[model samples]
Target: MTSPATPTGSTVPTGAESADAIVVGAGHNGLVAANLLADAGWEVLVLEATESPGGAVRSAQVTAPGYLSDLYSSFYPLGYASPVLAGLDLDRYGLHWTNSPDVLAHLLPDGRAAVINRDLDTTAASLEKFAPGDGDRWRHAYADWREVSGPMLETITRPFPPVRGGVELLRRLRVGGALRLARRLVVPVRKLGDELFEGEGGPALLAGCALHTDLSPEEAGSGVYGWLLAMLGQEVGWPVPVGGAQKITDALVARLTERGGRILYGARVDRVLTARGRAMGVRTAGGGLWRARRAVLADVPAPALFLDLVGPDALPPRLVEDLAHFKWDGSTLKVDWALSAPVPWTNREVATAGTVHLGADLNGLTSYAGALARGEVPRDPFLLVGQMSVADPSHSPPGTESLWSYTHLPFRPNWRAEDLTGHVERMEEVLEAAAPGFRSLIVGRHVAGPADLENGDPSLVGGALGGGTAAAYQQLFLRPVPGLGRPDTPVDRLYLASASAHPGGGVHGAPGANAARAALARDRALTGGLYAGVIGAAHRAVYR
Candidate 1:
């Protein structure tokens, strides 16, 4: 098996290489696509611009030695629930998952909290503490979710239009039922919470989950994301890799290599070489060319893929114009700490939770979101905090905590060092309010601002974590631009296999799996021509 490339300053071979398919960017999505294509017996070559794989799904001793912290994403409820990831059977490749005692907890100014435990009754009881009968409401909501979750998840993760999954969903929840569900999904999270629960506990839980995306509680369709994630956590506890986030990437790389796939690191693709309107291969910044016999799957952001790599001149005029209006999610600021001891939360239950949402109640959350929308740095920022050592003991030394928290910021062209430091202090203030003397426990700390995040991974453009905005206007069939919501781009033999495509972001590999499936379907000898003809015509109509 081939070893992974060095983490920095790796040499680029100066020669033209050829493979059955060239997958650009070695992010989890790109890796997932490569692994699937390799399983189909096609020789795959992955070109990563960075020194290593995993993009944001990486880990390092950022705060202090022996304190391993996930550089970007930490929790993975989606990863656990994702059929695509589960189908890969990563367990055989040394990937193990572990969860904290509780899935998540949302802390309030009053020191009260709403917690979700692996046990449904425990979660319901926690909500019931807020108000009488709220527990039953939560149970009912979960039951409803359970009835639709199977088909709902399938319809979500499958290729857009989700024909088979849609049919099953329709059969289960008739025409009127489907219409009602759709209406509910489009409602604002605040409204959905009010409709579903009487107490602050349930609503607070939903609102906290919704903030996980860029969407605020009042935004339309935000409730769907809130409900989806919350229910997924209930079904499958928010688990983390036993060691670090890197294990997930290592597992994908191991599986790909086992199937005879190759990955070239530090290979920054400068251009996607197209011949007669069809993608042929790519040329790296080092003046090396790699040709693909069949297809090229790009796991980069939409703007980078279309404007920078492919060039606007090569794309349809309409597509280029549409891209100019692409909306990025809010930028982010993250802080990591190697603590002398665990955060002494006012609510002891929060310490048992892997993820904690602090610095906001419903009204506080609304104000914080509003501040971000108006391009103002929030004084009371909502913090999504992770206690890494609690989730996976291997992340830090005994009795110590590897902790992190990130909050969204408005997009800015640049951030001075002082500006980042100031924001980091603000974030710490939020944490300190929830856990008094939180600052005293820090042994070391590292801060990553918006620019730092983008520099580390181009896909996280402007530090927008979900690839692009998950707003209603830019989702489903309209994601990355209006089209069939499939992976097929205007260019033939090229697919958008990143979170920029339909279904947006998360640790789930749906976008990559969808792209791989599209490539395979169009390469089949029997119906390949027909599939290409239909998809190509659709692209023409959309771009015309």
Candidate 2:
């Protein structure tokens, strides 16, 4: 671990360092790894290329100075449900979230809207209004979810060499708990919804919620994706940080440092340095070499870490081929709007709800997903708009509201700078369809196309927020490619501790925590004393 030394300036340089563990990036995963290792009495150093630590967990006045917008993920049910973070005690570090009563409201193309409230009974009751028996189905689904989500999260998300969750799941299958869950897993959300519910917009609306994270309800992996989102909505209600998403990162940073770790911003690590197939350390962009005496946990992308940093010669042939065949989700176009006032929704329910899902129904979601497969962008897009100032007033000055919305571009927009006006204009037209006169609400707007996101952060990979695709083919055991699902990379002592690993994305520190445990185990057994002595001397050298 190479922490910042020399109070004002750094001797164990940001781009260059020599420590026990040299972490490459300062994204949430990178930060999480640094915090965990530091707590374990290891010398840990973190390097972030961005000005801020959070990769997508940023809240800035992107549109106008006063209107604070959550840059990437806005509503976070996953953040609240994260076991890694739940263990961190971050409230003392300055992270607090406020949840509105109604978690989401989907304004249908027709004037009607389906509002999902925090209370399951109320949400079920609301569904009953849509259809007499749909309410019971909703409750039944939640009960089923309560059963499997634990097992699913355990097997899919637990730390490395994960056997317990897998063993338990296999045991359940042997007994018969797997039949219904297996059926749910195989059937697409479209099929699942058809069998379960009777409603005009309620089923489709719930599917829309599932589609929020860029999943297609028609796809195979999408059944679990859809059910989990719906279940979590009823179980935990979507939450946004009280101030902004940055508060979450701030809280994490505080706890990490308080645990005797060090953080450095504007530090860029170029490559993972290895000696005889074992991970040693890293080389920074500025030509400084930081060698790790024990382990190196990398928070960079898989391709960047494997191909660019460690080099192809160091990896197995099958792994290289898999990396080549590894798929990335299509590019995205995100827009942050600084509204002069609240957006006027046609269905008034969304005017107060935390999130608004606007787009076509189940069929439309499949069409959009299919369109991306054909490399065509959707004219009528699926948009999720989050009203920050609606639930939290401090996001903007008194009375005014802050709204940020996003829709994927499916095919990367290959247009010039002058062409952005057309893209933003098209996005506004899509918004105006659900929220009448949405153009009038726009006081200031900031546009970030696929290139902009990649420019801002390269790991975003065409601005696909979940690292790569969250589809069935690229999820769980197959994430970032098969066989190396847990955070361990091809290089010894170097772990891929990012969203690209299993149980992917959404501000959860599972990947980081998983990687840290792996590193800690490795560090404690064979190289613990050697790394401690070297890194401790490195820290004390500058301190004296």
Candidate 3:
């Protein structure tokens, strides 16, 4: 690695390019943390291993020139609705939203489709097409969402255990109401659909959303993920940043630079420097040492932070043992295309949708999910199709469409390179069934398997999108190997600020925002002591 000369700026302090904080990765979450810290008058230095930041949020013309495809994450309902992102005022920095007429459509085998729109009544009417009385159930669930979604989103997006949100939700729902809500939250998406609606349409819609996470429809705690995304789709239409996903990173980088923060691209931090059991600085692959006066936040996977950077020798024995059992979501295969024309969906309604979900039905989704869990690829795969041009005309050249689709594969697939080709072919076959002559519309195509995805973004370990599995046992307080369930790591002055942190994965910048608050609190002696005492007590109560 080549160690280049350190640059200069007022934000760059005297010794070793020092700053108030040193962020190890320049993913969206890392940028979010840096921006927040700099806004508070702290000198921040963000280091990225890649030549550019944005991690998986960046977009490119992989298929052909002028065909912009989001490299990884595409839809961002969470980004639109996230309170943390909202506070950042990204729009002022040149981020624009492009929304489709409908948020999402799930096409079924019977030629019927379930569609969700921003308008509640319209979405309800769509559900009515599936079953007569299911529309009423849809409205009832949304009515409940109106009462609790704010607190629920606040709770998940904030710190763990969500004490305040829990209390506020309890107050709104009452004791009996809260118990009922808990039941709904704990069950599998399949069970939730059965309990709430009698129609296949409503349940299928929910089950399709659950696939967005690694969780299968039958898994506990998946119902919440399904409920939240579907609710948010209805509340805030899924949107993409105008121009491309890169615009989001461009806006964030601009905001950070304006606030006097510096980002060092091509600086790969190899290890976290520690003195007296506290993080002091980072030693880069390029042999550069950057010190931090206050904190070091890592926007990387938990295993990378602990296993690679911190090392097992420095961590508590229990935590290290837990690391061995840490699970990963299934690997994924994604395909992007520069289409000669828009996808001609067999279902006319699906043609107008921003996102189209195709699984024969609930059974098809469940079967594919089960196949992944069993270390096998499914004969028939579930497809999540995004019509980028339909959502935003600027995504492609005039009259052309930029389209993409992805399907999950077994995390540890015992396969060959040829197997990946078969998977891609299978994915196309599945799509073709839904949209006849889809392959004929493609002018150019690109595919990324698990290896390609991980090579592109280290945080997407084993191609797990959420940074880790979203199973009930590993979520909430147990996330990223338990302990306090907050940003603070076992090592003082080092914080975990990535999708591996609380609130799991999404475009939402909660992990970064939450870590920033923790770091700021620690920087202030008053809040630091109080937070430490509480977190220490929480660790003793839970882990000890």
Candidate 4:
């Protein structure tokens, strides 16, 4: 195991034959895993297929030179809240976060908006304008969330090895916290929010937050996401980097390198070169064999890694079947707007907002979901709009604004070029209905369909951003399939360190942290506990 010369950006060809560990993708998660391993003396070498390190973590001047757009994951409430990320010391590596006063503003049909101010009193005061007591409901959920969320986050984000984390979480969280967490996690977001608030905008707020991952409010497991995000927003508030999302990645890359980790950007790993039941290394797509003596980690999704990259002979038969049944999260189509000015809102108040939601109502969100299920792009799609210029001034030239808005469509759409164009049109219509003349604000716009997402990185996998679906059926240990807790697939030491694994998605490093913990724990003989066996059996079954 050796730490070789620092390999530069995404174009460095790999001629090296061996390293301490060879990670297959330089996604933020892959880089995070490599850094953690390197910090523990693993001599990590990350090989990315792309010409750059940031996978979905990239920001580009895709539309114009002076304006930058975050390609994916613009608002990072979840990323900011993850405990695993807290320990990484990202701020020390040059990444900084700025919190806006009003975190979210959801526009309605009547030109009225539900604005969530960072201060609870301010948010409640605003809610009071919509209806009475809705303010109190906001207060209750926020206060309740403050009590039990810490342990709940730990259980959800910690490693799945033999399921030890769950047991430990229950042990650490008091009886009341455990009960509250259980009751909160099981209900539907629609039901939960409706039960709590008595205002015109309460359900709309819940629906908007829940749909961040494009999950309908009525969907199973919607409660967890909706509550976590909304409550977290009330707690820490949502923050973004000063320039764009790229600052987060740049900080991560700097810290990883500063900690003695080696990164190679352009060398794409074609396969994990394995022998027998043990892990060996990765061979770059261009015929360079970069072998890892300790472990071969893949930041790739489960399907691509197991079915496409590793041959069928490498996996168990049951896992082969599960791979076919694995559900992928819906694909994302993005539109970047380089605006001459802010989006012109009919209400005028939303123009200066940090983040705005565009849709009709809760019905509009439901309509969007129903249409997607029928393979039709929603006639009234709910779009998450980020006015980056409002959040951070450096995104554009003075008086100009950089805006990004995105929405989810079904994984397989009967899309011609018009289907995508039509979707964008519908998005504009919804925005226009909420904020009159939104279309007129567009100075330049760049559209990315599934093809464009694939062009950016094959890892988006048909533009499914979270690697796979975030629905209840695919979550937890069932994620990417049931069996293996480690990112390692049934194919020996090959691990799935992407967002598709347990503790799924977002810009958080939990999946990568989980994988690295598993790799190192194996070496340290630390995962031999009994709870681990159950977690292992579950992992093996899903992957089998």
Which is the better candidate, 1 or 2, if ranked by TM-score? 1
lDDT of 2 by residue, 12-102 (tens): 3345456778787888888888888888888887877777788878778888888888877778787788777888888888889888768
Global lDDT of each model?
0.89, 0.74, 0.86, 0.76
Candidates in order: C-alpha RMSD to true structure: 4.7, 6.9, 3.9, 5.2
At residue 37, give the lDDT of candidate 4: 92
Which ten-residue region of model 3 has the weakest summed lDDT? 1-10
Give the TM-scores of the predictions, in the order they appear.
0.96, 0.90, 0.95, 0.91
**320-342: candidate 1 lDDT, tens digit per residue:** 88988888899999999999999
In model 2, what lDDT does residue 229 have? 75
lDDT of 3 by residue, 1-544 (tens): 1112332111222467688999989899999999999999999999998898898899988999889999899999999889889999999999999899899999998789999988889888999977898888999988888899888878878988788989999999999999988987889999888987888888988999999888899999889888888888988889889888899899999999999999998888877877655788887886677888999999998888887877766666677778788888788889999999888888899888899898669988888898888988888889898999989989999888999999988886234789889989998988888889989999999998887887788788777788888888787778887666798887777899999888788988999999998899878866877876666556556544
User: Which stretches in model 3 have alpha-carbon errors above 4 Å?
Assistant: 1-15, 413-415, 533-544
* Number of the top-ranking candidate, with lDDT as the measure: 1
Q: After superposing candidate 2, which stretches have Cα over 4 Å from the reference?
A: 1-16, 160-162, 166-174, 411-420, 526-544
- Looking at candidate 1, the ten consecutive residues that score lowest on lDDT are 1-10
> Against the correct fold, how does model 4 do in TM-score?
0.91
In order of TM-score, best first, we have: 1, 3, 4, 2
For residue 351, give model 2's deviation from the true position in Å: 1.4
Model 2's number of clashes is 6
